[model samples]
Each structure stands twice: as structure tokens, then as C-alpha cells.
Target: MRLRAVRISRSPLLPLFLLISTALALWPAAPSTARPASCEPSVPYESGTDGYHTFRIPAALQVPDGPLLAFAEGRRDSAADDGDIDLVLRRSLDGGCTWQPLHVVADAGEDTVGNPAPVIDPDSGDVVLVTCRTIGGATKRQVVAGAVAGSVRRVYVQRSTDDGLSWSPQRDITASVKAADWRWYAVGPGHAVALRHGPHRGRLLVPANHSAGPTARSGAHSIVSDDGGLTWRVGYLSPGGDEPLALNESTLTELPDGRVYINSRDHDRTTEGSRADAYSADGGLSLSVPFRPQPMIEGPVVQGSVLQVRGLTGDEPLLYSGPSDPGERFRMRVRASGDGGLSWRPVWTVSEDRAGYSDLVQTGGGTVGLLYETGQRTYHDTIRFTRLPWVWRLLPELTVSQGEVSGSAR
Candidate 1:
């Protein structure tokens, strides 16, 4: 699938220029030398029920003890009730080469559970997992069927101190929202990221979007907790405006310079296009108006994730992965950004022939690892991994360096 280009009006360039200038001025200065390649490939882990299908959605989190945790949703069949959706998790201890057995972190009984987002809190050093659950089935008649089936959706939080070995009881974080809107369908948290530095260091910021009720318009909201995940303050990114143009699967990345950037699916794009980008000056408390779209190699879809490479050259390349469809076929492709997200270069294809979500992490040895779903014609999508050397993109530059520098210089 090909991403359509967004029109850039000459009027907005001045403000954008000033914003970029201010951001750069506040950024910490670093050595003029470019970052060395730090990503390498490793083996992937795979696991799931034999017959029932599973899909790894959103992004995956890398914990301290070497295990990578991914939140996956499973489906018995398409005919099954929508309320049957459940959240399952898998881990890869030895990089991504192999995976552990399926662990049902949250399951749908009379309620629905999906959209699992995992993050490792630096302050507590614990892995926190959040997912949205709907109490009632999602059908026209179900809304009129009964109070139980038409209940609202909510966001639940769980933490794992010892990697993915165990988890705390699910805690509710949707009490501040409207009761009916917080029902099973539209109420709940989306993706979250912890502050890496500064006074609010270690606090968690979760992006909650509107998904409850039939007539609700989706907007971006956030919850902040000063004491790790113990307490939260809820508010909207853009107060009293049409919900900021965004969808469910969004990502937050803290740059080396201390600014937090958010990339979200642009549901407001009327024509075909790729994802949209936003920024948070006050550590995700609020976001600027959505920026113009970037040209993505893949066509537009609702969910994707983007991560900033800590030590990369040419504008700190960002890795983005999401579903790309061209007509009837669906595939997953990864793209690289040289000048941030203003432009992109195609990197690799995670899945050339399947339907799933993917996550990327920079390993200790400077390799980039990807966790995604595999298995065609099967309902259960097992986690698959692939590693690429950090030097993959730098190979061309290295070749020139070898010709210019002598052995004594090395």
C-alpha cells in the first residue's frame, strides 16, 4: 500500500518554523558526531492456541530482566460474540527467537477485553499493563436488550513486578468520565508512556480516547500520576474542542532532548493517507494542534506505533509499523524517518503476507528487534521476531568512511 501526500499550505510554515526553533533551543546540546549504529537483529518468539486465533496488537514493551512483553487479543471465530474478546500475553526471554506459552492476563466472560498496552515504569521498575473492557455486547439490539448488556466500557490497570511472571489485580481508572460513556465499548485507556527525566520523572501518562456509546466522537484525553501508578488526574488534550483528530493505537516517545512526541492514526483524513503527528511541550499534559501529514510508504489504517532511535544519525530516525492494505491484500511494513516524521524511507517488511500489529526495541548490542504475528489461514497468530543490524542503513556511509580515513585514524 502507498501513502498519500498531505498538502502543505505556505501560511503555516512560519509557526512551524518557530515551534521547531524553540524546541531545538530548549534541547540539550550534544557532540557534533553522529550516533553510531545500535540496532541488530535477534531470533523471535512464537506462541498461541493451536486452533483459536491470536493477534498481537499495539506495541510491545521490553522489561529489565530481558523478557519482552506483548499484549495480544484472541478470537475463537468471527461468528463468536464480540463480548468474547480477551487479552492474552506472551514473553520472549531469549530475545525474540522463542516465546513462552500463552498467558490469559484478562479474558472476556460477559465482558470484552482488548487493546492491551504495556510499559515498564522506571521509578518502580515494574511493568504496567492496561486494557479496555466493555461490559455489554456491541450490537444494535444489545443496546436495547438489557442494562447489563448495554453497560459502559472502562480502563483497567495491572502491574508485573517480576517481569511477566505475575500480575496485580486489575484496577479501574475510568471513574472520572461520564458513567454511560464509560461503559464497555468506548470508555478505557489507550497507550501510555512514563516520563524518563525531570521533576515528574517516573510519572505515567496514559492517553484515553472516546470509544463509549454509539454517538460519541473520539478525542484525546490523558491521565497523570505523580506517585507512579497509584493515583491519576484525568483531562483532555484539547479541552472543549471537537475531539482531536486521532484514533485508538497511538504511541508516545521521549526524545533524547527531553521532548515527548505523539504519533497517532489520523481518522480525520478524508482522503487516503498515512499517520498524523503531535507534540506535548509540558510532558504530555496537552498537545498542539495536529500537524500536517507525512508521506508514508503504506496506505492509511487505524492502528500503528512509532519509536525514536536513541543513537541514530540524520535527524534521529523513527521506526514505524502498521497494517498496509492495497485492495484485498493486507501486509505489515516498517518505515524509517530521517528528518523526524517529515519524510520517511522504507526499511523492512515485518509481515509481507499476514494481518497483525508489530513493536520494535533497541537491544543492548545495538540490534533492532521486531515482534509481530505469524501464521496464515489459522486463527491463532503466534508472535514472530526478526533482528536487523544497526549498521544496515549505515553500511553505505561506512563504505565511504573506509575510503576517506586511513587505518591509523581508526
Candidate 2:
């Protein structure tokens, strides 16, 4: 898509048009140059192009320095799940216009490390990344069933003090966050949010998923840090039930009442294409409302993202991104909500072709940035970054013409 340049009139004296016409006749009009294009995408990672066979599970965060850091899993062998996977990142200083070279944040020889969940601390201006790792040979199915020999899934935390230019060594936090019965665990495949209002103003909440069952299934949860990234503790884990009741891979947004609104991926076949949502009142210690479907959001049980854009005084409109079609992962679209997340309206369609697993964030300039997985055929073909205009730019334009405009065109 091409972006049209905006035209602006610099002359303020419209009534003095006769006087300005004398000067305009002497000085020819200056040549017009196009403003930089918007909504253009840059590929941060592509399979087979960067030595890795695949790059999946993207997470993005814009640090205080104004550079966007995009995280993904670099799979070395093939598009399959279990392999020599490492956590990698790409940096973009000028919104999403250009990208820096690949930077591997965490690599463990032939081991698997992925699912980057990053949150920036408002007070300290530091960024923390929480991820999961496992042995190279172990698959998620084997880990979920507890068929593996020893502890399979482990959690780790790392920090970046210099605006994602460098990172500290990984520290294991499995014992503090994971239960003994849980086998399959994963941090968010998206970015986490920090609270800005009410009692839990500075709390950092990271959305996550785990599997702990007599029947062995998956459920969604959160891990939070109050005193910054120095420490972390377990929050709430969703209660599991019969078939079509399992929830996983969640995204979070802070409500006006200091509660967290979670939108989760449903694993049960009964619900099929819909997502389940819940709320945490006690700062994610437990759920105030259990997981249930909202008819407004129709997704194919895939991971989606929610972002709360803050206004000058308080919470503003909330944004959500996912596939518009309930049956397939196509028509990647974004929606907006005025009353938190109760109702939604389609803001824009990011892509009509194949797309999956997107994370959204408001950039420093107030424009929205989307880092997601998209391709022509498969989901893991490439990781891309897309920028969107603010709400004012998307308002409907009223044009008067001699011919009647159809309602469908409007």
C-alpha cells in the first residue's frame, strides 16, 4: 500500500489573497516532497534467510530510549516445535521504518528457549524479559503429559539496562512461579503491561499459561512483580473443568477499578473458535470473574493481544488484535472499545492474507505498533512490524459531491 502525502497551506492571511498573489507571482511555488510513508512493514526475522529455519512467537516492547525491541524464537532445524531454538531480538529506532541486525538474547547450545514476555518499569526505565526453556529433544506434548524423564519446562528472567543494547545473564525462576504438578509452562508470546492507576499503580503483570492436571491440560495465569524486576511471585491460575473448558495464552489490560481484564485462548473443542475472558481483582492473586466468551471478540481459539491506551487524566479506549474469521487465521484485524472491553468496533484490517499471533503497543508518537507473524503460505515464514495511525487519523471524512454516495461506500 502507498501512503499519500499531506498538503498544508502555510499562508494564514486568506482575506489578503490579492496581496499574496503579487508575492506568489514573483516566487514560484516550492516543490512538494512526500512525507515518509506510513503502515510500511520491515521484516525482522525470516525463516532460512537468517541461518535459522524458522522464527515464531513474537513479543515487542518500546523502551524509554524510543527504540522498539522485537523478540522471537529462532529455530535452527525446521519449522517443528522442539529443536535448537534460541531467543532473538531486532531493534528499530525510528518507529518501524528500519531495523537493526539480529541479536540473540539467550542461547543454550541445542536447547530450546522461547516465548519472550517483556515489560518496562515506569520508575526505573528498565526492561525485563521472562521466557521458558526446555531440552532440545523434549516436545510440548511429552512435557504436558509428564512423559519426559526429568523436569522439562523451566522459566527464566533477564533484564536490559541499556535500552535493549545488552542484557544480563538469565536467572531461573521456575521454583518461585511454577507448581510442582505443572508440566507444560510458557510465558506470554506477547508483551506485558504495567498498571497506571488505582491501588496497584506500578505493578508489573506478566500473562502466562501452564498445565497441571490429573487429566493433564492447559490453563492461563499471571506472574507479577511489585518492587520492580527484583522479585516475582505467582498470581492466579484459572480453574480447570470438563472438556472445552481449558484456557491458555492470555493477554491483559488494566481496568478503571484496579482490576486486570484477561483475554485467553481456549483449548477445549467445545468452544472451538471463540476466546475466554476473565478478570483479576486482587492484583492477579485470583480471578474475580471466571473465563467466559464475549460475543464481541470472534477468534479461532488463537493467541490475541489487548492494549490500554492511557489519556491525560485516566484510561482511554482499549485496543485488540486478532484474526477476524472464526474458522481460519486470516483477515488480521484490529478493534477498539470505548467502555473497556464490553463492546468493540473494527478499527482497521491489518492484513487480509495469512497472519497469526500479533502483539500491539502504542508508540512514543501515539501511533500503534504491531509486531506479528505473517506469510504467504505458513505462519512462521516471517516476523514483521506494522505501524497504525491514531484514532483521529482514522475518523470518517465527510465529502460533498453532486452524485449521491452509497451507504456501502461510506
Candidate 3:
């Protein structure tokens, strides 16, 4: 069977771009990054504290020097993925030290609406959120296998013009983004990216994953919009079959040199690590480099977040937040790569608790904000936000694979 694939851009400068990227990717990480002494996290949503059974899949987005908006799936009666879930949000006027009250951005009344992958349209400073909507009766696995009854899986979007104070209602965009044969679809369980450079500059990208019928093998793609969020299209579809790239819960960031770097969860876990990465030079419209396992950056089978943060002294490092412990979903570690998405070294571990899915957003200056699922018992108990100082760079000093001490910094 023929597989859906992206049309690779044939720019004359493509070879030069690949050469630069390859050098950066292979360059050894410097062992000189400094981590903060402690990450005093602020709980934005505690399970059962806000009349909800749980809060999971945290996604945070903020424009430059703007208010920090934190988003999550508020499960009403249970912690299960398929249930009465609403896309809830909170705002932080100051970095991330404090947060405002909870607000339900989109609620489909007893149905599920989540996976809030929010992005800012830099031209108008508008916040656009993309989420997946489905019936509460059907599980993700059931939907993937094409055995769903009521609304299997759909896509909805909302825009906030007043800095997250109110949304402009949920508008369905499933028809344009999802293909005919696609069985299961999901938008980012985290934040999206707005391109600032490259030929497709000003385009907004949402990295997503979907499954097909007959076999239900998962595949990753990019949902793109060129004219703000007014219109959408399927940008690229990663080639399927026997590549060990059954990516799920994908996240992306625009590199310093105007490229899209996508990191995804290996749902099938066919490789050694639970994560794989690729590069898209043509703004996420296609992958310049296909997905491959990144063994240096370790994590469990969980949703992770990545962002390109600006350092205080002109450095632009790509920061990734995920569980450092490959054995279990604990030791939420923050890592950084000075040369785009080439190499990574630890900045510091958030905690040794049962931490799992996490998302990262730059909170201005040299500090970064993290919204993650962590608890004393299970990762779904509560979702909290913390700040990390991004002062220095890193070159792998040690390679201790036990836990948090995966040594890039300390």
C-alpha cells in the first residue's frame, strides 16, 4: 500500500541547511550549564481541590512579555483519559509565582474536549488553542481501531483576544485537518509553535499524531495555518510502516535558525528510548530529517514538552522537559541543547515524585516555567507549575543513567 508522505522542499540551499544542522546535531554538549538550587513549584490545579477528579495534560503558552496562560484537561468524575473532560485554563500576570482562578475555556457537556495545544499569533497577539473532541463512551484505543460509536474523534479551536480572559467559542476544524482514512486523531497535548523565520514565516504549527484503520498503526503529522488561525491544512504526513516511528503526542518548537524541531512519544516503544525526534526546515510543511530515536535524552513512555528559550546573554537553547527516569515516570528533569535540537544535557530535576507528562514555556528573561503532572502517589494526582533558571550552557560532564543525575549540568 502507498503511504502518505510530505513533499520535500527542493530549495537549492537545502544542502547547506542540512550540513549546518548535522554539525550541530553531532557536536558534543558542553559541560558548563548551571541549574537552580531548587524549583519551588506552585500548584495550579490539585485533584479534588477544584471540584474535579483530576487535571492532566498541561499546556502553557505566553507571548513575549505577556501573561502566562496555563491550560489542562479537567476531568470531572475520574482520572481516566476518556471521560467528561473540559479544557480549563489559568493566567499568571507575573512570571509564574502566582496564578489566577480556573476558567473553563471549552466544555462539551459530559463529552471530552482536551489536548489544548495553544499558540500565539504574533501579528495580532491572539492566543489560539487547538484541542481534540470525542465522545466520552469511546476510549482512545477503541477509536483508533475504528470501532467507535458516537463522534469518534474531532478537532476544535478557540481564540482568546483579551489575554486569556475570554474565548471566542469553539470552532470545529476536523474536516480540514484529519484525512479520510485517519481513524484516531489528537492535537498537541501541549503547546504549539508560531514560526518567526524560514520561507513559511508567520505560519502557526500544531504537531499532532493519528492512527489508521485495518492496522491502527500510529503516525505523526503537522497541522498548519498560514493566515493566522483562520484556515488550516495538513502540512506533512510522516511515512508509515516498519520505521519504528509510531509517534504519538507530538510537540514542536521553532529553532533559532528558522526550522521546526519535532519531538514525539514512541507509542509503540519500538526503540530503546520512549522518544524520537525529527527536523523540518520548510516550516513543518515537511520533515527535512525523519524521526529517529534519541538515546541521549531519556524518558519513560510519557508526553514531554519542548521549547526554544532565549538566554539572558544572547544564547538560544532548545529546552526539553520530561521524566529523566527511563525505568519509571519520576524525576522530572529539564534539559537543554545549545545548538538547536542537536544535543541535550540536564539542567536539573524537578522532583523525585511520581512525575509524568510535562510542558515547558518561557516566562521571559532567563527563567523558564514548567507545568507538569506530579504527585506523591501517582502522576495524575495534581498538576503543578515550576520555574527553572536558564543561565548557562552544557556539555555532558557525566552519564549516570540511574536517575535525576543523568548529568549534563547538576
Which predicted model would earn the best TM-score? 3
Task: State the lDDT of candidate 1 residue by residue for 1-410, as single tens digits.
Answer: 22222222335344334422332454444333322232233323333353343344534677765686656666544424254666776787755555677687876674667777677778778888767766655542344333444345566778888897888878887664334443223322224677876765787776655544344434445666767677666633532344444454456666655566666655555334656666766776776545345446455454666777665443556667665664322465667765656666545444455645566666433446665554575312455555543333432111111112111111
| Over 4 Å off, model 1 | 1-51, 56-58, 77-81, 138-151, 177-191, 211-215, 235-246, 289-291, 311-316, 325-329, 374-382, 392-410
lDDT of 1 at 323: 57
Q: Which is superior by TM-score, 1 or 3?
A: 3
**Candidate 1 vs candidate 3, lDDT winner:** 3
Q: How well is each residue in 1-410 modelled by candidate 3, as lDDT tens digits?
A: 22222121335544334432333354434223323344346788898867789899999887666788989999999999887998899898765667899999998888888999999998888998899998656777778766674247899888988899999989988889988788888988899988987578789999998887577788899999998999999987875566666788989998877888899999878888888999998899888899988887887888899988755445657788998888788888888787787788876666778998889987654467789999998887888887653322322322222232212222
Task: Give the candidate order by descending TM-score.
Answer: 3, 2, 1
Which segments of candidate 3 are over 4 A away from where they belong?
A: 1-40, 149-151, 391-410
lDDT of 2 by residue, 61-80 (tens): 98865688989899998887
lDDT of each: 0.55, 0.75, 0.78
Global Cα lDDT for candidate 2: 0.75
Decoy 3 TM-score against native: 0.85
TM-score of 1: 0.73
Count of clashing residue pairs in every prediction: 29, 0, 5
- Candidate 3, number of clashes: 5
Clashing pairs in 3: 29-395, 30-394, 30-395, 31-395, 33-393
Which candidate should be chosen as best, given lDDT against the real structure? 3
